[model samples]
Target chain A: MSSEISSRGPADHDVRDQIVIAATEHFSLYGYSKTTVSDLAKAIGFSKAYIYKFFESKQAIGEMICANCLQDIETEIRTAVNEVDGPSEKLRRLFKASVTASLRLFSDDRKLYEIAASAATEQWQAARDYEVRIKALLQDILLEGRQSGDFERKTPIDETATAIYLVLRPYLNPLLLQHNFDHADEAPTHLSSLVLRSLSP
Target chain B: MSSEISSRGPADHDVRDQIVIAATEHFSLYGYSKTTVSDLAKAIGFSKAYIYKFFESKQAIGEMICANCLQDIETEIRTAVNEVDGPSEKLRRLFKASVTASLRLFSDDRKLYEIAASAATEQWQAARDYEVRIKALLQDILLEGRQSGDFERKTPIDETATAIYLVLRPYLNPLLLQHNFDHADEAPTHLSSLVLRSLSP
Candidate 1:
């Protein structure tokens, strides 16, 4: 099989989407590690070679699914933060929304969570990209807060953002979430409050 | 094999200590997961039944070793904090010292770190007890800071301590340390400063 998909046509895009959808369903039912490329091909009624034309490997497919899941969570967080008024409120909303979205994924689609957890634990590019995006969003909020005279400008934006990201890592990281699962709801609120206090001008 | 040692005499204590010392050396050399009870017994010149008299299982030996490692780290942190004058300084030292001690384990004793990581991931009683003790230490420091007028008393102490513990969890938990290893040195300084800023009266 070619290393590249080799097709950019609308039909090919549809086939790619179909493969992802079918693979996600198969992985959800059978678990990610247990499901093989052959199983995916059989479930999707495609030849193994045909599946290979659209994807390089099982992990390549998993990367796409993991990215999609993270994207959905990011969208939810952004929507929640945007719905709020001030930077402080937005930061609080961001924290609460992030925990809510993550816990939902953990409780609702645990099989998908296993894939994301592996992506995180293994340091997959998808997980790294997601981390960069989340940190960017945080820095954006910090910049906004500083400009609006809501947050203190004494601390460097990047360092402050990294610290906040580290604080939120336990809840967002699937491997660490089992220990923090019971505190998922209240911990965010408490942490955001502490963080907001530090951010106060 | 008997679950209990059945003897509280000094001889029994020495024998138990010898088993732990031998098991630790064996685990450190061959790694934890790869070593078994029979291997440990063979290396220690004890029968498998003799080894079981002192510990219930391989994991029990692992628990003792893990507890010893954590206890060593905690002693280092406490010493660093005690050497400082003010609560704020002690708090900062706590973070720095905790990170330093943990990173030392991660780098110098990685074989043992595997055991600690497993203990954390599996929610072992040793890990839980370690967490409780660490949080208690944080709470004690927070209380001192508040009483001495160095920290704000607006928030409840337990919640505040819990939040700070969560912030430090990534650096301390071996399971989560793989991602945060690069930042092990600087992140603690940045985070402790952020936490201290929030604590300021």
Candidate 2:
């Protein structure tokens, strides 16, 4: 997140960012079940009370770390949106970027994502929240396509966008992503083409 | 399995079928880990030795029951294919049948589906096998569409169909199916329309 400083504006944003990084490292190196908030604070040269001042509980800190990882994908989507010339290209890039970025979280820290994928647990709420945000981002891209005439206007844009998100669920889902990663690692590319062709005017 | 009688030639089919039905009932009601082959044998008024003659282990019986359920779905797809007129209609019916049937597994027997979704376990192989058959069924639909000129012939039908399966993973996968089932309960309709629209010539 040191590279993401330009996206921040809060006075204490740096401190929170540092804490997030420290917590992520602690959770990764030692298991999340084994790491406590006090360990996070002690490793970051702060008191446990100070960590609590920012995050309500250990789960909250875990949520923040998950949220931060999600934001990294969001940033990647934003970059894709900005760099493209048309909505089709932007949508393609966004889909590809999101899949690649999300899969990176699993490959980078397998244990952390294993915790995140435990749908029966409380932390799954954070993962579901992240999914909603991703769907919203997809809707935004579809709306842009409708305005630019790259996509047809026959159906409601929201429905079409939501459908696209649903169709891409297998690629975006961490649990399903591993299966696609093996088949020449080309599901995102194939899916982006299928989606683009589906929307063409 | 009456229609599938040709798929087997053994005279002991009746006994095997009864044992399978008993085991499925036990697993569905009491959970897989708690259900044993001995209990299944007793429930069906069969000796443990006779039950062992059919299935080497309790898990083997469980796998057969799962395989039987999956075959029921395969029969559903076959009926849809034979009853439908066009490839587009066949694809639509196939998609809807798969989504609804997969979701039915979760809703109809949450305990059984829950065990199936635990992909880390050994029984996940059966689930994986079921997925491969579903994908093959999807490809068959796409192939018909391509041949009938209902869908474009530019892309490889296999890749395109695989992409569709990937996109609909949320609805088709037991783990993700439960989440979508609680939301609007109409994702199958929406997903079918989206996939069919994408395949149009």
Candidate 3:
């Protein structure tokens, strides 16, 4: 990875991706407070000054990582919804995708989730922006389901989407980062059942 | 509070209670790593020797505080269940009381919840003990409702109770401490509807 980065031009997009990958590992291991730019630079074989050239600060790097993870999750959810046939199947796939994405993101580096949660409280603007984007994505799926006559939801789609996110948050949130991932399987199962039951005709 | 302590005999129980209260505030403020026996001693206006006389270490003091908080919550829940008239009402009151107690305990001290969540990971024994006690309490309530025909649950009461707790946990867990308590009012409204809808014959 270091050799690839050295071979690339300074302005190459791959360099940015490499930095994010390294930062993700560092942040996961040391958490936000302990993960310095110097450590990230060292991990990726880049100078601290070069790291700052691409990302303004450690917080900026963290924000990018968060956005990247959430964006990937959103894409997966959209693809899953598009591929599945029925309302029940759609809901199952949607939640399964969410759980899988969330678990995968947090599985290797649990501290990233903790940092995200802390960022939500400490950095209101970024956190709220991320939340709005997520809520909109959820709303779109629900609206799509309703339009297809597969889901008969009486509650406002947006409100119901927000509620579902809030209700499933404990399982999704970073605070559960320390819990054994193997044991966390029950959450997605129960949550999918509850949401499907609520939305069932 | 100090006067009340002074009035009690200088027995080990009184000393232990005083230390626990002080420890709660200390743990609530700086969390476990930062909270020290000296800080707790200072908070209680006691010497380090006196502190050690009642508690073995800072970790033990933390354990005691958690034990007391859990006991208080369990007692409140049991009392609420007994005082309420019917299953629906009992369930509602139980939810209300649990939320209220959680809010009261951590309302002014958000770090307490953080400490608890962190402690759950750092101290596995305490976490398992706490989980078992809570499960038993919820199981008892579910059994009572089933015996009275107030709940039409086909699943084993223990499993059903665990499911209900998991569903309610996002709202109640300390990690989501930043949540608006006003939203809690809406939670039970939604939860009761879900419960009634699921369990109604």
lDDT of 3 by residue, A79-157 (tens): 8767977666776776677667777766655687766666654653556675676667666667776888766567667
Preferred candidate (lDDT higher): 1 or 3: 1
* Positional deviation of residue A10's Cα in model 3 after best superposition, in angstroms: 15
B60 Cα displacement, candidate 3 (Å): 3.2
B1-201: candidate 2 lDDT, tens digit per residue: 875666555746877888888777877888878767777778888999999877788867777777776777667767866787988888778767777677667777876775556542353567779888878878877887888889888877777877787666666666556545543366667777887778878
- Across residues A34-118, which tens digit of lDDT does each residue of candidate 2 receive? 8888888888899999888777888877887776666776787778768887778888887778777778877888867755655
Per-residue lDDT tens digits of candidate 3, residues B1-201? 988777665777877887777677777767767877887777789999988877777767777766666677667777877887877777777667777777776665666666665655465355557667766766676677788887766656655676677766644555444354546667665665565444443
Model 1, stretches more than 4 Å misplaced? A1-8, B1-8
Chain A only: TM-score of every candidate? 0.94, 0.77, 0.70
In the range A25-86, model 1's lDDT, one tens digit per residue, is: 99999999999999999998999999999899999999999999999999999999999898
Report interface Cα RMSD per prediction: 1.8, 2.3, 3.2
Best-matching candidate per TM-score? 1
Whole-model lDDT values for every prediction: 0.87, 0.74, 0.67
lDDT, candidate 3, at B46? 94
Decoy 1 TM-score against native: 0.88
Q: Can you write out model 1's per-residue Cα lDDT over B167-189, one digit (the tens) per residue? A: 88777788777667767868888
Q: Worst ten-residue run, lDDT, model 3 chain A?
A: A174-183
Candidate 2: which stretches are off by over 4 Å? A1-19, A33-50, A80-84, A118-140, A175-184, B1-12, B36-50, B77-85, B118-129, B143-149, B182-184
TM-score of each: 0.88, 0.78, 0.70
